[model samples]
Target: MCDQYRKSYRLGRRPGEQGPRPLSRNQDRVEKLATGTATTTTTKTKPTTDSSTANATTTNSSTANPSITILTTNPTTANSRKTNSTTVNPATVKAKDSSTTTKTITDPGRAKTRKPNQTTTNLTTANSATANSATTNSTTTNSVIVKTRDSVTTNTTGTSTRPARITNKSTITITKVPKCKTQKLKITKNTLTVGTWNVRTLWAAGKLDLLRHEMNRYRYDIIGISEVRWTGKREIPRGDFIWSGENSNHIRGVGILLSTKAKKSLMSYNPINSRIIMARFNATPFNVTIIHAYAPTSDSSEDDIETFYNCVEEAIEKVPKKDVIIITGDWNAKVGTDNTGWESVMGRYGYGSRNERGERLLEFAAEHNLFICNTRFQQTSNRKWTWESPDGIHKNMIDLVIVQKRWKTSVTNCRTFQGADISSDHSLVLCNIKLKLKNKPRHNQRYDVSQLKDQTTRQSYQARIEDNLKNIHSTCNLNEHAAQIEKAVKEALQATVTLEKTSKKSWIFDQTLDLTDKKRKAKQIKHLSADSIKEYKNLCNKVKNRHDRTKKSGYKINVKKLKKDYKLATAEKRTVW
Candidate 1:
C-alpha cells in the first residue's frame, strides 16, 4: 500500500499534470466499505513538488512506532524530500511543514485531533446513528465545539444517538412519639443538722445564753427544746426561739431554736398549746416541718395523753404531703431494746424495756411510718439514754427524734450529746442528715478509727505506720512537728484502713441481765414455801388491783374535768363573740 501511494504521488507531480485530485465521494465510500472500518478520510489540494522530492515519499517503516509524517514541497527545495519521522502520541498531532501535512490515523473509535490550522471542533464517530454526534465549526483554540441533534444520547459503547430517560422512586414516613417517662426535679438542697433536747425546764436565769453558747459551738441548724417553760406563744427576741405554752402556766412548754441559717429558711410557726409546737422551714428536694412536743408524764391521765397525741396528729396533718416531717421531743416513753413487732418504727438499740407510754408512742410512729432515729443507731448505754433519774441510777431513752421512714437513710447518726448542758436533766439528742445543696460549704470528712481494732487491720496498720514513720525526721518547730505527725497518721490510715461509720455500741449490760435474773429467781423461790408464795401472790394481786383502781378513778376524773373545762371555755368564747 505504501509503494502504490508513493507511485501515484510521483506520477501526479509530472511537469504539466494536474496536482493530485481529491477522491470522489463515491470512491471514498467504497474505500471505507472495503476496509470494513469506521475511518474518516479527508482530502485537500496542494501545489505539486519537484519529481525528486515527489519520489522521495518517506514511509514510517516501523508501524509499531507510527507517528505523523509531515512533508513540505518547498518551491526552492522541491527536489529533496528525505526527512526525519516525527512521532506524536494520540491527542496531540502537529503539522511541522506548513506547505503540505500528513497525519497517520490509528483508531477513529471516539474522537479525532483538531486540525492545527483550523478551529477545534467535536469529532463524532457514530455506529448506526445510535451513538452521540456533534457538528460545530466555530471552535476556539482551547475550546471544544460540539453541536448535537435534538435526540442525541450517549450509549455505553458511544456508537448511537438515542436519548435515555431516568426515573426515581423513594418513600419516607414519620409519626409523633411521646416520652416514656417525665421526671420531676429538685433544684437545690442543704445538709440540715437537727437536734432535740428535753432541757427539763428553761426557767433558770441566763439559761438562754447557755443554750445559745452550746448551739453556736455545735452549729446546729435547728433544735427542739422541751419544757421551755415560757408563759405564752411568742418568739423570743434575739434568740429565734419559737415557743408554745399554756394560757397561764410556766410548765410543759415546748420550743424550737433556729440558727441564723435556719431562721432564714423558716416559713411559718404554729403553737398548738403549752406542750406542742410546730415549725416549717424551706428546703430543697422538699420543705421540712419540725414538730416539738413535750408529752405528759406516764402518770398523767389518759385524757391528757389522748389530748396531746390528738394535737400532734392534727399538727402533722396540716403539713403538705410533699414536705419532710420530723417529730422530736421528750415523749417520756421507754421504747426498750426489743424490736420484735415494732421493727418499722423502733430499733433494737433502744435503752431500757418498753413501757406503756412507749407503746403509745411506738404505735403513733408506726401509724405514720415514722422511724425513731435514736433507736436505729447502736450506741453505748451512756449515750443512748437522754434522761436520768435524780438518784443518778435510772437512765432511759425517753427523748427521741423521728422522721419519715422514706428518708431514714438521711439520718447518718442519732444519739444524745451528753456534753451539752443548759441546766437540763435531759441530754441533747442530735441527728445528722445529708442534703444535696447548691453552693453549700461541705463539711470536713471524718473517718472512724475503730476498725483498727481488728487483728488483721491492726497488723496492716502497724506495718503502714512503720513505713511512714521511717520517712520522718526529728523537728523542733511546733507546726512542723504537728504536721509530720499528722501526715504519718493520715498516710498510714489511708493505706491500711477502710472507712466505717461511727455508730454507737449496744446498750445491753451484764449487770442488767444479772438483776433481771435475780428477779426471776425470786419469783420461783417464792413458790417454794406455802406461806411465802401466798404472801407474794397476795401482795402482787393487791398492788395490781390498787393500780387498776387508781387508773380507772383518774380516767373518770379526767373525763369530767375535761368536759367541764370545755363547757367553760366554749361559754366564754360565745360570750366574747
Candidate 2:
C-alpha cells in the first residue's frame, strides 16, 4: 500500500557564540480511519525547557512499513532551565506540552531530538524505521542509573518487540555524529547471508541453464552477480536490474544482480559506467550501499580493463565512500603475485601490496579500511579456470567480496558455496556475518553523569575508575612480560615451525661448520614498571641450547631438518655455519 510523508529541517547558528537549536518531534497521529476520512500530518515544535519533553511518535495499521518524517532547525536562544530535585524518579516524561500518544519502548532509548518545533510519523511498516535527528554541543545530557533486574523478555503472544532505548539529552550543538552509531537498527532475523559471486558469463555454462534453480537453492538475503553480459545499448537482459553495472562481453557488458530481499530497501541509485554499480540500501543497518564490480583480468591488455578500473574508482567516489559498502562480484585480478598492478591500486588507501588478485584484493581492502571475508581456511588456489574448455586446461580463481574494515572483527562463519557451482562455471561464495554487538554495562559508560556528579560520588566513582585505569596500566606493563615470554616460547616453537635436528648424511659429514655469529642487538627499552630482562636472557639461553644440541657429535640428524637446512642453504644470507 502507498503512504504519504511530510518533514521539516533547519540549520542555523545560535546567538552569543552559543550552540544552535535543533528540535525533532514525531507524532504517529491517526484519527481513526473513520468512514468519513483520515489523513497524516507533521506537527511543528521548538526548543523545550526540558529535554525529556521532546519525543517521536510513530503509528501504523499493523507491524509493516509506515510513512515517516524528520525535522531539524538551526539554533535559537537556548533558555537553560535548572531545577533541583534531590530525589529523582527513573520514570521518563515527554518534552513539550503535546501528548503524542504512541507505543514507546519502556527502555529509555528515547532521545530529545535536535530539530525545533518539528514532528514526524508514518503508517508504512514495510521498511525499516529510520526516522532520526541530532544536534551537537546541546546543553542536554542523559544520565542512566542501573538497577538489577532479571528475565527481560516478555513471553506474551502477538506482541511487538522493541529495542532497549537509552536516554540522551538534546542540546544546541552542531557536531556531525554518524546516525548509524546513534540509532538502533532492528534485526529482522537471526542472520542475513550477503554474498558476491562472479558468474563468468551468463551464457557460458552447459550446466548454467539451471541458473534459476541454483539461485533459489540457498536462503540468501542479498547477492551480487558480476559479469552479466549483453550487447551494448541493448535492453537490460534481467528485469530485476535494480542497479546495473558495467557492460562487457567483447570487454564491457558485465553488470550486477540483487535479490528481491535487497531490492526492497533501495533508496538512491547510481550506475558507475558499464562495469560498476552503486545503490544506497535502507533499513535495520542504517544507510549502506552495494558496489558491484569486476576488476580487470591480468591477462587483458592493461588498457582493455581501464574503463572498468575507472568505473570502480568512480563508484568509490560517487557513493559516500565513508559509508559501509559491500563491494562484491568477479574481480579477475589476482594478488599475492609480483605483477605490481594490484599494488598500484591498493596504494591509494594507505598500506598494502601484493600480487595475487586475492592478496592484492586483501591489500586494497586494507588500504581503503575494508576487510576481506575469505579466511585461509576458505581460501583456495586461483588455478582451475571457472570458465573451462572442453579439455579443461585453463583455470583461475577470481571472484570475491570485501567488507568494511570495522566489521571484520565481528563477522563469523564465512564460507563458500562451492556446491552451487555445479551449474555455473564459478562457485557461489557465501558467508553468514554475525555482528557481536557489544552490550556495554550502563554504569561503565564514559559519559555517565553519575561518575561526575559531586565530590562524594565522584570520589567513589574515581576510586573505581582509577582501579580500572590501573588495571589497564598493569596490563600494559605485562605486555613486555608477555612479549618476553613470547620470544622465549617462539624460540621453542621455532623448533617446530621448521626442523631443528641436524642431518647425519655420512656422505657429507665434511660439510663445513662455521659460526653464524647471527648478530641481533636487542633494542632494550628501559622501564622500571616493565618486567625484568631475565626472561629475554632465558630466551637467549634456549637458542644457545638448541645451537649446542644441533652441533653435537654422533647426533643422528632428523630428516625433516635436512630438508629445512637444504632450503635454508639456498638462502644466500642464511647458511649452516
The RMSD (Cα, Å) of candidate 2 is 30.6
Best by lDDT: 1
Worst 10 residues of 1 by lDDT: 166-175
Write one digit per residue (lDDT tens) for candidate 2, span 1-577.
Answer: 1112221122443332232243333212111110001122223223334444233332221211111111122112112522121111112222221222222222222332211111121111111232222111222211111111212222122122332222332111111211122223354354546776666555432212234445676877566766655445322333234334334444443444445555445565666555666666664443567787767667867566656655665677666645566677777754432334433232222212234445645555656666555532233343212333323345444555667767665455455654554224566766565421122123211232433446765565545544444333234577776665544543433322333332223211222111111111220221122343344344444434444455454345566678788887888666566
Cα lDDT tens digits for candidate 1, 283-395:
87788889988889878999999998999999989999998998888898888999998899977788888899989998999998999999888888878998877445688
Instruction: Please give the CA lDDT of all the candidate structures.
Output: 0.60, 0.41
Total clashing pairs in model 2: 72
lDDT at 525, model 1: 48
**C-alpha RMSD between model 1 and the true structure:** 35.9
CA shift of 451, model 1, Å: 60
